[model samples]
Target: MTHTPLLKPVWLSMTLLLVWLLSACQRETDLVEPTTNTTVSNTAENETINKWILENMRDYYYWNDKIPASPDLTLAPSDFFDSLLYTYSATAAPDGDRFSWIEENADDLSASLSGESTTTGLEFMLYLRSQGSTDVIAQVLYVLPNSPAARAGFKRGDIISKVNGQPITTTNYASLLYSGATNYSFGLAEVQNSALVDTDKTLSVTATVFQANPVFLDSIYTAGTKTVGYLVYNQFVPAPNNSSGTEYDDQVDAIFSNFKARGVNELILDLRYNPGGYTSSSANLASLIGKNISTSSVYFREEWNSTLTPYIKQEYGDEFFVQRFLNKSQNIGGNLQRVFVLTTDGTASSSELIINGLRPYMTVTTIGTTTYGKNVGSITIVDDSGKIKWGMQPIVFKSFNSQGQSDYSAGFAPSIEVQEPLVLKPLGDITEPLLNEALYQITGNRLARRAVATGHSLPALGSSIQRKAGGGRMIKSLTAFKTAKLPQ
Candidate 1:
C-alpha cells in the first residue's frame, strides 16, 4: 500500500497556527519544584542552564519521510538540561563555529547563527542591527540568488575571514560581523573554511551596513493605470524580542489602511525571501485577504506529551482566532481589489502560510519561481537525557476556501511566472524585470514585444497564451481531513 502528500491549493490565507513554546518557555514547564534548602531564599528564582536550540527537533512522520528510530533517553532533569542544551553545559560545544553566549535572562538577547540560520538568514538581524552591535558576520546562509549577499557571490558555507582588512575568527564574530559604521566602506574575505585562508582561497568583497529594519512605502507604485497597492513586508520576527518588528496587533492595520487611503485597488505584496518570524505575524497578514474569515476554528497547532504513555504527541489541530492587527471594518474588496505577490524559494514558513491562506478571496497572482515547499512546521524538544533535538511535524489542521481547496504540497500556483535577471556588468546588481510583467498583466495594458525581457517562457507581449503553472502538491481538502494527505 502506497501513500500520498497533503497540500493546500493556495488561496493566500494565513496557514500559521501558534503552537511550539520558545526554549525559555519550555524550560519553565520542565522545571522541578525547588527544594527547601535553607541556603537559598524562596524568592530566588531557579536558573535554567541550557543551550537554546533555535529550531524544533521532534516531529510527525509523513508516510513518505523515513521515520528515524526514537532514541532511549534517561537522565535527571538537571542533567537533562545540561546535556541536551549545549549552551547549558558547563562548556558549550561548538555549533558549526560560534553560537551565542547564553544567559538566563537573555531571551530578548540573541545573535545570528554562526552561518545564517537556514530558516532565518539576515532577516533575523533586523532587530539586532537596530539595537546596534559591534559583531562581524563570519558566515552567511544563501536563501536567495541576487540577494545582497548572494548577488555578491556569497554562498551558504562561505565563512568570513576578514572585514575591511580586520581578520575575523570564531571568538570575535560579534566584533567583526555586527559592529560597523553605517555606510562604511569595508572589504571582506570569503573563506572556504574558518581556517585563515591565503589570498588564493578567499574572495574579497564589500557591503554597506544599514539599520536592519526594511522600510515599507519607500516607493509608491502609481505607474499609470496600474491600480496597485504596494506594501513591503519582509521577515517575521516575534514581537518584543525583535526591535525591527512592529507590534503584531497594529502592523497589519497600518499596511491595509494605507492601501485603502491611497485609493489603490490591486495589491503587490513583496515577500522575496521572508523567513518566518512569528506565527502571530503570519495570522495577522492572513486575516487581511481571507474571504469568509472564520474566527473560532483551529488555525494550526501542535502538542508533545512524551512524559505520558503513547510517549509521543497527544494530539494536534489547526485553530484560529481573531488577530489583534485587523481593521475594525471588513474591507475585503473595496479599496483593495486583488493581490499579486513576489516570491522565491527563499520565501518560507510564515511566508508560505500567508501565500497559501489568501488564495480564494483575492485574484492572487505570484511572480517568481516555485516556493520553498515546506508543508511541515517544527517543534523542539530538550529531553531529560540532555540531548537536544529539534522535532518537526506538519499540523493536521488546515484552512480552505469556500470552494474547499486545501492543497499543501502543490503550494500556490502563480497566475504568472517571472524570473529575476542577473547581469555581469554591475557585478551582483540585479534587475527585477518580472515586476514589470506582473504590473502589465494587472493593469490591462499589454507590453510591446520588445519591451519584454528575453529568455524563459511566459506570456510575452502580444502573445495571448495559456501556460503551465509550477505548483502541484498533495493538498488536504476538507472532506479528506482525517489523515488523508499524510505524507508517504
Candidate 2:
C-alpha cells in the first residue's frame, strides 16, 4: 500500500479528547454565573465554550503555564479566549502569544487554511496618501484569478481612492470595505506629482466564495546562459478545497517536472506574498529544491509543551514530531547549488520554514525585505462532539531546523535587500525590482536604480493578507493525535 500524504480531510478527523495537564482551578461544572452585565447572549453556552477553550489552551498552548489560574468564564467567548492568552505586549511580554486565534465558525477557519474564503478577491495594501495624512489609498496586489476583483479588471498596482463615491480615510475605509457587504464599487486614482488625482472611473465587484489557487504563476527564464525557474507561489496550500486531493501540490510538482525537463539550472522561488499554509505542501516544495535530500533528511523538528511532548512520544513514537523531505521524483536541487527566494514582510511560517529548512542543505539567498518571522506552528482544534461550534487555532509548537535553530520572531533580513517600488510591476516580470536584484546577484547583472519620487510613496499601513487569519501558520495534521484520550 502506498503511503498517503496527510491532507486537510484526514486532519479534520481528529478526536478532541486529549489528556492534558490541567492547572489547579475550579472544575467546569463548578463555575458560577457572573453578576456583572456582559455581552454574551447565552451565558451558560458561552461558559461551556470558554471551558473548552481553557482546556485546549492548557493542553497545547506553547505558554500553557502562563494562562491565568482563574479566567473570567462569563465573558463573551472571544473575550474569554483572549483573557486566557499570554498576549504579546511590546513592553510587558514581548515573547507572548501573537498568533493564537479563535473563530466562531470552525468551517470558516478550516476553509481559510485551505485558501477558501468569502472574499472580494481584492488583495491590496492600504497606504497613507502622504506622510502624516489621514487620507488612505488602497493599492491592488494580485487579485485571485476568477474572483470578483479579477472579474472587475483589478490588476496589481491599480489605486483606489474612493469607495461608494466617497474619499477613503483612515476612519472609514474599514467600514466601507469590510462591512459584511457583498457588493462594492471603487473609484480609481493615479499618483500625479506626489498627489492622488481621482479619475472618472469606477469598478464594481461582488464578493463570493473564492478558492485561491496558491500557485499564482510559474515561468522559466533564461538569464545569462542559466536556465532559471521562477515560481510565484502565494501560499502553501495543497489544494483549493481542503479535500484529500493534492491539486495545488500536484501543480507545483508538475511545474518542477517542467523545470527539470527543460534543464533549468537556477531557481528563483518567489514567495514575497506568501503568508503560509500547510506544512505538508511546504515540505513538498522543499523536497523539490533541497539539494541531496531524501525521506530520511530532517526538514524540521517540533517542540511542544511538556505534557504534549511526552504524550506524543508515548502515543506516536519518537519520529512522530519530526518532518522529513518527501521523495519527489522531479527534484531539481541536484542541478543547482543555491536557490534565490524573494521575500517580503508577508513571507512567513511555512515560507520561512522552506528557507530555514533548506539552508542546512544548500545556499539559500533571500532577496527583498525582512520576513514576517514566525517560527511557531499551530493546529486546528474543533470539538468533534458537536457541542462546541467554535474552532481554536492555538500555538502548539515551535519548529527548528536540523541545526536546532528557530530564532526568527523578529523576522529574517534579506541577503540582498530590495524594497519593491510603490509602482508595482507584474509578478514574474524580469524588470520587477525584487526579482531583478536576485538575477543581478546570480549573474552579476547591474541592479536597476528605480527611485520612488520623494513625496509620492508612503509606507504601507497594511495589506489584505498580511494579518489574515492563519497567516504565518504551520498546521499539524490531526492524524498525529488520533490515538489521544483524556486522562482518566
Quality of model 2 by C-alpha lDDT:
0.77
Please, what is the TM-score per model? 0.48, 0.90
Off by over 4 Å in 1: 1-211, 214-218, 223-226, 238-249, 291-332, 379-406, 410-413, 424-431, 446-451, 454-488
Best by TM-score: 2
Return the number of clashes found in candidate 1: 65
Cα displacement (Å) at residue 179, model 1: 16
Question: Scored by CA lDDT, what does every candidate get?
Answer: 0.36, 0.77
Which whole-number lDDT from 0 to 100 does residue 2 have in model 1? 14
For all predictions, the C-alpha RMSD in Å is 14.9, 6.8
Q: Residue by residue across 103-206, what tens digits does model 1's lDDT show?
A: 12221112110011211122211011112333333333222333355444555434444555665333553344444332222333333342224353444333
Clash count, predicted structure 2:
0
